[model samples]
Structures are given as structure tokens and as C-alpha cells.
Target: MNTFGLVIGLITLAVIGIGAFWVIRGERVLGYLWWPYFIGAGVLLMVTSGFIKNDWCSALAGVIGASLVWGATEFKEQAIRAELGWYPFGNHKKRPPFAKIIQKWKPPNL
Candidate 1:
């Protein structure tokens, strides 16, 4: 019986779980303004995965990349949750560089 698909699926599930956890923590500590950087990193990982020679490695990289993209889209909502008192609000969150520029653009949602 082939277990490749099963293994990959489990790995993906794990990655997604970790992604959700990080989205909350990241937003609280780093703030949602870093969404653009997350998107760029995710896209870069996905693009770089195409050049991998090992199938397992490529699949894992793709899963992680997709999770990052999903988490990035959730950052704005995460921030809202904190503001609404649903999540712990960080008093001294790190400000993203170019904060003024980022505020002018709409953050991604999914």
C-alpha cells in the first residue's frame, strides 16, 4: 500500500495547524502590518519548490508555502480579533517598516 499521499496529507495538516497558531502569535507580537512580507516569503517558497529534485521535499515545501499564504491573509482578521478583545493584545507590538505606506493599502483577506 502506498503511503505517500497519507504522509503528505498529515504533514499538510500539521503545517496548517502550526500556521494558525503562528498567525495569532505573530499578529499579537509582530502586528498585522507584516502581511505583505509574509506573502512575499510564501510566494518565494512556492516558486523555489519547483526546482527541488526530491518529491517529498517539494511537497513539504509547497504545503508550508500554502500555509504561509493562508496565514498572511488571516493577519488582518487576527488584529481585529485582538482589538475586539477576543485575543490577547500586545501593548508593545513591533511596528513594521513602511507602516504609513502599508496602511494606505488594503490588507488581503480570504
Candidate 2:
């Protein structure tokens, strides 16, 4: 059992926990603070893919970076779902900050 692999798995789990927290609380915070994060992650992905000595580390970076990019799309859909009243908005005990952002985000009509 490679320790590096174990470390990577732990880091991935951490990412999942953080990402889930972000998703559950609300993606508006993410949207408001976007671009820099995804861009940095992309750069990190490329750098790790090229410079990392460990295969697991490089692969982990690539996966994480790609997931971040994909997460943007998922976040958008989550916003849409929230607008459509499909998903629970923010914490179950509190009202979501939906009016602040989603009100201004009108989806294109088909």
C-alpha cells in the first residue's frame, strides 16, 4: 500500500467534504468568488501534471482540477434548481439567499 496513494485518497475525501459543504450551503458564494479559484486550479493541474514526480500526486491534481471545472457547471444547475424550487435552498432551518443572486439570473428561454 503506497502512502502517497493513501494521502491522495485522504485529500480527495477532504475535497469532497469541502465541496459538499460549499454546495449545500449555497453555490452563490462560489459564483461570487469564481474564476480565480478555477483558474488557479487549472494552472496547478497543468503544473502538477508536468512537474510532479509522483504519479499519484499528478493524477490527483488533474482529477481535482477537472472536478472543479465540472463543479462550475453543476453549481449553475444547482442555482437553476433552486430557482425552479426543485432543491432545498440553503440550510433547512433558514431561508436561502436566493433573491439576491438568482433573481438577476434569468435563464434563456427555449
Candidate 3:
């Protein structure tokens, strides 16, 4: 409906799309890249929103965009786990309960 709203909507879609692409590529890559891209997209959406207006398109876009990206992330994680036969949900706790497999990383002595 308004100029800013349209921009926000487009930005949100772009964010979601990029996240999807990352997911489709694989979760390890997505996990490494998703958060930054998501944050950047959210900021851009809010900036383009300027002030809330009649078209709630930006809000809707934000919601859908977040969901899409998050869903993609989850999917990618699961896929990686499945591919590796490690855990159905990687280290997500809720799935493939493998807490015993602790990975302790200490900084090398300098």
C-alpha cells in the first residue's frame, strides 16, 4: 500500500529466500550463515517499515520470513544428522538424545 511497506515486504522475502537457498545447499552451511542473514534482513525490514502503516505486509513478511528461514535451518540440521547417521536432530537435545557425546574445546595454550 505504501512505499516503505513495499520495500520491507520485498526485503523480508529476500531474506527468507536467501535462507532457503542456504538450507537447500545444506545445514552446516546454513547454520554458519543463517543467523547473520536473518538479523540483517530483520533490520532492513524494520528500517524499510519506518513507521507501521495500513499495510501490515511488512509484519506478515517478517513472520513468514522468520518461519521460513528457521524451518529451513531445522530441516537442514536434520538432513545433515540423517546423512551422517549421527543424530536425527544433531545436538538439539530434544532429538537423538546424545548428551554423553560432549565436545570440549579449549583454547590452545598461547
What lDDT tens digits, residue by residue, belong to model 2 across residues 1-110?
A: 56976887788888767765565444544442243345456567767676878787777777677556555445656666765777555433322346455436543221
Q: Model 1, 25: alpha-carbon shift in Å?
A: 0.4
- lDDT per residue, candidate 3, 25-54, as tens digits? 444433322333444564555555545565
Most accurate candidate by TM-score: 1
As for candidate 2, its clashing pairs are none
| lDDT per residue as tens, model 1, 46-106 | 9899999999999998889988999999999999999999999988989889999999999
As a whole number from 0 to 100, the lDDT of residue 92 in candidate 2 is 33
State each model's C-alpha RMSD to the native: 0.8, 7.0, 11.3
Q: Weakest 10 consecutive residues, lDDT, candidate 3? A: 101-110
* Greater-TM-score candidate between 1 and 3: 1
Q: Candidate 1: where are CA atoms >4 Å away?
A: none
Deviation from truth (RMSD, Å), model 2: 7.0
**If scored against the real structure, what TM-score would every candidate get?**
0.96, 0.50, 0.34
